[model samples]
Target: MKTLKSRPSAILFSCRARRGVLARGLNTTREIAMPEYLSPGVYVEEVDAGTQRIPGISTSIDRARWQSLVAEFKKTVVPQAPAWTDSNDTDPGVTLLELFAWLTENLLYRAHDIPERGRNAALRAATALSVLGHRCTTECATLTRAHFFAGQLLDAATLQAEQDYHREKLRRHNRMLHGFGIVSGLGVHVEATSDPGGGRVIVDPGYAIDRCGEEIAVCTGATLAFPSVGNEAFVSLRFWEHPCPPDSPSASGEPDVTRVEEACVIGFAQAVSPPALALARLIRADGGWRVDPAFVPPRAGAVMA
Candidate 1:
């Protein structure tokens, strides 16, 4: 019997052979023959193709782990500094720890994903506003139109009805789809009241859009009166549009009517629905009314006051 000298390659070969045996036991019929190592320096053993490779662990810190790490740090500090007992948010040490933790959390998030500038660059020139504008223009262009044949008789009523329909469609397009709001100059100001105990305010002339997409113009401004019933009252501008026909018939014997009849009503209370815009909040104290400094006027199409 000849004795074989032990080497590192021989030990590796024995381990691989044992692994192949175990693999064969687990429903694998493939046979693996150990390579003879006559001259040994370094030998490479191929891993089993059927075996699943273990994935590397992620170094990214998640929200839960970050919070745990902050908590652990806080706990560790108590043992090192027994004199430091205050752990409230008002404490300088705790505030600094929380600030540092927040910064670290943000840094970790940025490290794990593409930068914001890179993502924005990927979008090129397209934006939310541009996409919406294109969609509105396309929809308006593709709107259905009534077709008239050569022999079809045209009447004033029919023409007027068609015109009104298209006008309404255009109005809706501009109001709902295109976007409507006060373009500029709708400022509410406190004014002097004739009655000593009454509160009065005046709205500056401005152009705005109503909830129904109708354009409203404050040509000469409007006055709002706040009653002394409550300590606080919200002032709002209300709009009403209705069809107003002329009292006399037109020259063609048809009714001359204005479809877009605009009216502005200043109310002491907040408006509950559309076609309205909140102007200001009034606070009454010592029999005098003043505009609340904290009141913020919301834009059109926003939540109703």
Candidate 2:
């Protein structure tokens, strides 16, 4: 006769109880754990998966809501004595509503784009701002100054806001126009010094033209020569365009070098010296505008041509 063997039945209990009993007081933490079974069997426990879900906000819904608001505003808010019949895009009032709806939809989408960890923090800050009767600025993939102010009333909290508004607008304008505009401290320039004859370097003069009355004919740092001691040093750079267009005679035939001067630029000359020179000494690892003194040495008072 064949003999039969029996396996021990599995027992389930709170991890807190097992921790004290099986761990012998070594561990005192309370947590659920599976009991060890003498017999071989598969055991599985369903764990709660926590994921905060944000509901989708459709753009069509936003558009419909805004259209309804616009209709209400025209019918009830505005007096019909003068007549407010224009309800199409041609009407500035209706256009404003459409723009607001588009922006609202975009903002809702952007909110979800934030990382999960950052979303919580951003939402908390937004809530605080809302309570204070202010809303957090929505960022777009491609943002411009025009997007910020379109029939919206700007409520500046402090005196600095006035300056900040101008600075931000100008910065965006310069970025879009690139070389045509002058932006102080927004770029870097490096040059090898011809003075006193050493491996010394100086910040390029393109950024300095803002202070001096002398105008820049060409803002490209190409005028500067490379240092003999190093390879091409500059990692990134910027160039300024001559504010005045090349003297060109118009159809009427008269040389015009006229240019409208820009106003309200941000900070100026943050970098006193070339970054490479500012840091202790130059090494192969350090990179910036390089000038070779042996060949094509820098000339004194060689203004940009």
Tell me, by lDDT, which candidate is best: 1
Residue 240, candidate 2: C-alpha displacement in angstroms: 18
Q: Write the per-residue lDDT of candidate 1 for residues 108-133, one digit (tens) a residue.
A: 57897635454333222221221222
Model 1 scores a C-alpha lDDT of: 0.45
Q: By summed lDDT, which 10 consecutive residues of candidate 1 come out lowest?
A: 18-27
How accurate locally is residue 229 in candidate 1, as Cα lDDT from 0 to 100?
60
Cα deviation of 152, candidate 1, in Å: 3.2
Per-model C-alpha RMSD: 36.8, 28.6
Model 2 misplacement above 4 A: 1-156, 179-198, 208-232, 235-305
> For model 1, how many clashes?
0
